[model samples]
Target: MPKMIFVNLPVRDLAASTTLYLALGGTLNPQFSGEQSSSIMFSDAIGVMLLTHAHYGVFTKRPIGDARRDSQVLLALSVDSRDAVDATLARAVAAGGRADPNPAQDHGFMFSRSVEDPDGYVWEIMWMDPAAIAGTPETA
Candidate 1:
C-alpha cells in the first residue's frame, strides 16, 4: 500500500496562512481549502492542514495548545542537500518565518537547521549523506 502523511496546524488566520505557505513553495489542494480547512500539498503524499482553532477544537475535547507561546508539535522535513536546506529556509524566512536561535549542525554526514513558521510551529529542515547514514551502524 502507498503511504501518506498529514500534519495539521492550527492557524489564527486561514487565508494568511495559506498565502504564506504558497510563498514557501507549497501547493494547495482545492478539495481541502475552503471555509473550514486548507490542505497544503508539500509533495506527492505529504500535506498539511491549516485549520482554524475553532474548527480544530472539534477534533479534541481539550483546549488547543498555544503554539505561539508553547508548542503542540515540531515537524522536520528532509532535503536533497545542504544547499537545498539553506534555500528552503531562505524562502520560509522571506515568507515570514523566524530563524532558530541555535546554529546549524553539520555532523559530517548530516546537516540540520531549524525555523519556526509564522504561527510558531517549529520545523527542522535537514540534509543527509545517504551513504554515510547507512554506514553509521549506531543509527540502526
Candidate 2:
C-alpha cells in the first residue's frame, strides 16, 4: 500500500462522533471501527480516527486540550460540487452537530463551508470546478 494519512481526532464521546460522521456519507471499517474508537473511512486511506478522550489519552500522556475551548486542528475535505458541502453540513446538523458561523466561500469557481463538529473540531467542505479553477489563475 502507498503512504496514507489518518487524522486522529479526540472526542468526548466516540459513539456520538461515529454517528455524526456516518451520517455525513462516511463508512466504518469494522476492523478499526469499534466502541472505544472508530476508523471513519472517508476514502480508505484518508480516514479519521475518532477516539474517546479517555481512549486517546492512552497514546498521549499529555492532557487533551478541549477542542471547544481551544482550536487544536482544522479538518478540511474537497468535494466535487457545492451541493456536496451543503449536504454534508445538513447531515451534520441532523446528527447533532452544528455548522460554523462563517458563510460559504463562493467565488464563482469555488465554494466552501466550514462546520464545527459536535466536539468543536472545524471541518471545511469545499467544491472546486476544474474548469472554473483553471480559468482563475489566482485560485490555481
Candidate 3:
C-alpha cells in the first residue's frame, strides 16, 4: 500500500476552516470528521486534519502558537499548472484567507503564491514544469 500524509492543523473555528478547505478543492471525509475536527482530503494521498484548538491540545501539551504572528511551518501544495496555482489562491481569498502573505516566487521553471487562512496558517500553492523536475529541456 502507498503511504499517505495527513497534516494536522490547529484551527480556531472548525466550520470556517472546513469551508476554506472545501473552497480550495478539498473534499470532506465524514468518516474521519466530527464536531471538534474535520478531515479534508486534497487527494488520495494528501489530507488535512483540521482540529479545534481544544481538541488539538489533547494531542500535545504545548500551547498553540499564533500562526498570524509566529511562523512554525509553511505548508506547500503542488498543482498541475500555473493557472491551477492562481485558481487555488483565488479560492482561498474568497473563503476569507489573506492572499500573498509571503512574496510570490516566479522562477522560469517554477511558480508559487501563498495564502494565509483565517486562523493565519499559511499555505503555499505552487506549480513547476515537469521537464524541469525530470532534468530535461522542453522540445518544440
Candidate 4:
C-alpha cells in the first residue's frame, strides 16, 4: 500500500478554515472530521487536518504561534503543467488567499508560484518538465 500524508494545522475558526480549504479544491471528509477538527482531502494521498486552536492545544504542550507573523511550514503542490500552476494560484487568490510576495519562477524547466491561505499557511504550486531534468546541466 502507498503511504499517505496528513498535515495537521491549527486554525482559529474551524468553519471559516474549512470553507477556505473547500474553496481551494479540498473535499470534506466527515468520517475524520468533527466540530473541533475537519479533514480536508486534497487528494487520495494528501489530507489536511484542520484543528481548532483549542483542540490543537490538546496535542501539544507548546503554545501555537500566529502563522501570519511566523511561518513554520510551506506546503508545496506539483501540477501537470505550467498553466496548471498559475491556474491553481489564481483559484487560491479568488478564494481569499494572499498571493506570495515573491514573483513566479520560470526556469524553463520548472515554473512555480505561491499563495498564502487565510490562516497564513503558504502553499506553493509548481510544474516541472521531465525533459528539462535531462536537458539542464545545472540539474545534472
- Candidate 4 runs further than 4 Å off: 132-140
Candidate that would win on lDDT: 3
Per-prediction count of colliding residue pairs?
0, 0, 0, 0
lDDT tens digits, residues 9-127, model 4?
99887887887778667899999999999999989999999999899989998989888888788788877898888778777787777887557888888999988877888887889
lDDT score, residue 27, model 4? 94
**What lDDT is obtained when candidate 1 is compared to the true structure?**
0.82
Give all TM-scores, in the order shown: 0.85, 0.88, 0.94, 0.85
The candidate maximizing TM-score is 3
* lDDT by residue (tens digit), candidate 1, 1-140: 57999898888878877877776568999988898899998899899999998898888777777777876675788888989888888887877778773478889789989877777787888999998867767676
Evaluate all candidate structures by whole-model CA lDDT and list the values in order. Answer: 0.82, 0.82, 0.93, 0.85
Better of 1 and 3 by TM-score: 3
The positional error of residue 131 in candidate 3, measured at the CA in angstroms, is 0.7
Worst 10-residue lDDT window, candidate 3: 131-140
The number of clashing residue pairs in model 1 is 0
What value of lDDT does candidate 2 attain over all alpha carbons? 0.82
Candidate 2 lDDT over residue span 30-124, tens digit each: 99877789998888578889998888888999988877888777678877788888988898889978785567788878888977777888788
RMSD to truth, every model: 2.8, 2.7, 2.3, 2.9
Model 4 scores a TM of: 0.85
